[model samples]
Target chain A: MKQYKHHTLSVLVENKAGVLSRIAGLFARRGFNIYSLAVAPTDDQKFSQITIVVDVQSAPLEQITKQLFKLINVVKISELDPATSCEYELILAKINAPGNNRASIIELVQLFGGKIVDIGISQLTVMLADSPTKVDDFEALLEPYGIIEVQRTGRVALAKQETSSAKLRSISGKVS
Target chain B: MELTGAQALIKSLEAQGVEVIFGIPGGAILPVYDPLIDSPLRHILVRHEQGAGHMAEGYAHVSGRPGVAMVTSGPAATNIVTALADAYMDSIPMVCITGQVALGSIGTDAFQEADTTGITMSVTKHNWLVTSAQDIPRIIKEAFHVATTGRPGPVLVDIPKDVSNQLMQWYWPDEVDMPGYKPTVKGHPKMIKQAAKLILEAKKPVIYAGGGIIRAGASDQLKTLAELISSPVATTLMGRGCFPDEHELAMGMPGMHGTYTAVTAIQKADLLIALGVRFDDRVTGKISSFAPNAKVIHVDIDPAELGKVRHPEVPIVGDVGYVLTELIKEIKNLEKKQDQSDKSAWLKQIKDWQIRFPLTYDKEQTKVIKPQFVVETLSANTPEDTIVVSGVGQHQMFATQYWKFNRPNQWVNSGGLGTMGFAIPAAIGAKVANPSAMVWAIDGDGCFQMTAQELVTASSEKIPIKVAILNNAYLGMVRQWQEMFYEERYSEVYLSPDLPDYVKWAEAMGCVGFRVESPDEVAIVIEKANAINDRPVVIDFRTDSSEKVYPMVPSGASNDDIVVDPSQGQGGM
Candidate 1:
């Protein structure tokens, strides 16, 4: 089987303009096929957090990470495993509904454990939380109803509570 | 008592005895520049802000002083971040300053405005956004103090545009006070005694010196200790040139691409006394099997790094220079005995490996030449004490494997970052630091293409550093992979199309140039490059594209699994 690559990058960037563009350009120029990207503020005394997800084998991913670390703004890069972390995504969608079909949209939203955040006479807005891939599936489900304005907060993750980076200190067992 | 914050800043730096600063002129930092124009402090205007950062790094490496870099806000600060990270990783002392938008307009996104404090947090040992004009003197003092003290690294001070321009009462306090910051000065006496006891008791002990030796300015002390113990010494890649490489006990770099002698010596040691060096993965192959039998004593300045990797039997945490001072005292207390563990067996094994797969380039069968010769001859002709900088790749490996580096810090490469285009500019920095010593840039064709523009920096400054380009017409590492694993599906490995004739390129930059086609010409051209003392010289050797770095541990592979000398089928034991 061909080895698909997975990269977990921990970026410490200033929460400001053009940073996302710089990061995206870095990935696009380097030929990294980003599978998922997670951005959030960290609990540090300074700086914000950005997590990039790229699909490639370990060697190329290592190369990507090394290159990314060399970027002037990239503070740190760590390849995190999905198994060790819980990942989530949020998606907002607007679907046009003329009549009784509008109730179907509301029922579908409730069925998927979502909520109607906004409503208009011609269009209804639904918000859902799931995996990014699942968000894609939700977008697909609302396609026939002429869905519009799809906004996704890409994958955000927090490693399982008990096993902190402190716990990971002894991965090689040669130290701590 | 009356002074501008800018004048106060300069006075504080001068009081700190700052002789020089590396920087470029910019708008936001005009206040500091205006004051600097009249100060006794010498300023070297580097071509780029990034160049200033690396120049500071080189100066710091040489002087054991905190090198200072100044820049404007925004891209300038960002540009210096790599050098900041470089110093952070290697524990070099550097003070970086950037002018910011004033406090009133800080978050307003004014021209050249950047959140300097936010951008530099993770990359710096400590950073401050100086708000008040009065804080200027204290902050500059603290920045230097923090940057040079224990676990040295880059410290940043972000001065606002107006704050630097503001008038203030100026006084250079003889002492500084930062209540939260006090580094450990003295090592635990018990721990120092324990490390000395371990060294005394062990039959086979090795002192693994690192860049910490350079940072601590303890090369003379390291040499003394190695002689006192009568043990062979090995160093990490970053540790190269810290101890005189020519010392009989000096085994070259140890790790994935380490010399055979160094690796085997490290493996056979019963006790490893690691001083001021981090056990990077490149040095310690799969950590589990690395020096499995050795009882390790790790001496470092940083407490956090202690027990972080390969937990030492004794972790003596404090300044390296201070710890070494105490260790020498403790050694005087121990009873002397004859060295018992016959390192002969281990030494013989390493010698046998070296002889069997001695780094060689074909003397007779010379079609496409070998890069190995370029460095070997360059190493022989250049002063043994000369500094050598390299761009990372196949050539870096060959430089480490083939070149004899008998002294400390003679070899400077972007080890952790493996940065391309690092060689030319880094050599320029090294030359700037040590004006009398010959500096050579051992670069690969691919890496030379990255930042050779720094040739102008060298030529303009008249800081002469010889460049030796290992001109293999391929991305040698990728080509090796294609040959070994991809069934020769060579894609994107050819660099011939993009490469320029380096000789002409060097000439255009107002430097002497030489081109070598055969292995025999390596020494002659290198000698010629060395002879041209007035300007930098570049020598391009057209080497074979297919040559590979031997004793390779496939990424993340265990230490035991090294592929030695692929061309000769001499596999590792």
Candidate 2:
């Protein structure tokens, strides 16, 4: 029996047109389900960073990683372990806060370190940037407020500190 | 020195040692063709853009070099998509250059415009859309580099007309600076040792060779290792010529339609050393039950293929040639010989299976020439070094089964994609690559008709390749499938013999044509066709339509359930 687990991978690829679709197409073709994917330009203008969260069975991890490397634009891949990585997701929700409900929704937003970003006559839009689990908790707490619309920026992650070790180590101690 | 992008492109191709290019000229590509007229590289104009692509593949199949094809934008680029996909599936190294709309009008639906890069992205190993004329030299170099390196496949470079026509300084890059495109070619020493240990310790080990062996030119290393370990070798269709079929240890092609001995040996093996082969679904019928008892040592250049199908016990990612060379050296150093008593018993069991279920067909009873008989006769008459090509269908299977491939690159076919019209164009390419070698395209009636127009290109180019069409009056393979699985409904598989008159078609194409209906005439007609060295010849062997490819493990069925003869009650276990 293989256990299905969520894996966060950071990929550095050539900043070129159609590179994103190439990566997405690979994931789709290989049947790897993406839980969340985020892409943004890196410090280097020549390269872009893509953070992809995939829900896959244990057996396909090696294959998935290798397949990612097969893409010509993909330069590097770093699997971010949950234990040593900082991961965050941002969500914005619009609640139908009719007067009485507005105060309580605002109170809950403050309790979760969220902000009341926009205010309308009958609705208040709340924004929260936090770990995925906290965002889930905040969404669940505000479910009773009759949320009208919601949007989420998928998870983005980075290692807390760069490990000064080679990405691939030689078994025979001879530099490849 | 300053030069036009088209001139630089031609110079770069010359730098890459390209002898010839198969293609047709059109509007957007005219600038490139203009420079080509003065270039030393010979251009063979093809009937269709698709033929050009397949011709390149056929050339690559024999030459072990990246084949080149060029086409104009839009429909020409789109027409070659099948060949690109076929090359991708079979891992053939090919470079395709497509002329695109000018950079200014790229997205505006300009005349003779298509998103060649976008359309070919998923189908190619990699592709580039050049926006600048200065990038031509580097991109061409990169295109060839990527196409020929690590798990080789087709790469496309789409050049806008403006880019090709624009003036640019000509200088070949000192190095390809693709930081992302490095391939691991050498196996880890420790893993190689581990693989050797496994080989020596195993009682019933099978060397399962695939196309990687041929692509890497590792057939000699593979043969040496197999012989050293005294293991019986079973080749996948892609790996048909990687191992000599006449060798004592050779168990011909394994999987669906595989020889009984070969398929059974894989099923009953205790250890499987898979070299350069991905265990595709067609080869591994039911994944869970495939080589259930065996520990697999999967060796390939592509790491993704390691655990994509069955999880290999020892996964070594490297070039097949390099890995096998190191592995053989490691085994030699270890100086460990297999336990002779147990090894001989395993060999004896395999010998029994080979003798008991040899590939057989009723040649005597059928009045009509059997397709297998045609292939067998063709095999016997051709030179030992003959390069045989085929399109996808019953004739492809018959050619793969009957033809004796004594050397690597002697057999070429669309093994992975199984493209229907691969024969004529690929044969032309092979003949172009090796003008001295005899090349034969063994095709089915259905497959031959799909791309037979390329025969005209062959005639014009003076590529004297011989074609043997197994002219069964039906789409034989599909009809066989419909017979067994679809209750003999036979749907739309019939192809009438008298309709097109293949003989007249060949004569019209400026080639000698012959039709052999009787088994007695099969050899005589093949000899006559073989004698024509001045121009292409097409021999139509009208064959028995009722004959089916046997030893078929119906799609998704276990190897244990292989149906050898549908006429017999529930083909043997």
Instruction: Quote model 2's TM-score for chain B.
Output: 0.98
Model 1 - which docking category? incorrect
Per-residue alpha-carbon lDDT of candidate 1 for residues A117-165, written as tens digits (9 for 90 to 100): 9989889999999865677777788888998778887777656667457
Give per-residue CA lDDT, model 2, range B1-573, as digits (tens). Answer: 999898999999999999999999898888999989888999999999999999999999999999999999999999999999999999999999999988999899888888898888889999999989899999999999999999999999999989999999999987799989999999878788788888888899999999999999999999999888899999999999899999999999999999888888889999999999999888889988898889999999988888788988888989999999999888888764544325888899999988777777886765788888888888998888999999998989888988888799999999999899999999999999999999999998888888999999999989999999898888889999999999999899999986789999999999999988899998888888888999999998888889889779899899988877544446545
Enumerate the candidates' DockQ scores in order: 0.03, 0.50
Q: Which candidate is the best by DockQ?
A: 2
lDDT of 2: 0.90
Per-residue CA lDDT of model 2 for A57-79, tens digit only, reads 63366678888899999999998
For candidate 1, the TM-score is: 0.74
lDDT of 1 by residue, B1-573 (tens): 989888888898899988888888687888899988889987877777777877787777666688888999988988888888777777778999998888899888888888887777657777888888998888888888889887788899999889988999987766866543556767888888888888877876778888888777777778888777677888777777777767777777788877666776677778998988888888888888888789999888776566657878998877777888888878867745423344555556655765775555454565657777667777778776788788888998888777787766577777776667778777877777788888888898998887787788778778898888888888888888888779999998898923587888999988898888877777777777778988889888888887777766666767666666655575655
Model 2, stretches more than 4 Å misplaced? A1-4, A57-59, A161-176, B336-341, B565-571
TM-score of each model, in listed order: 0.74, 0.96
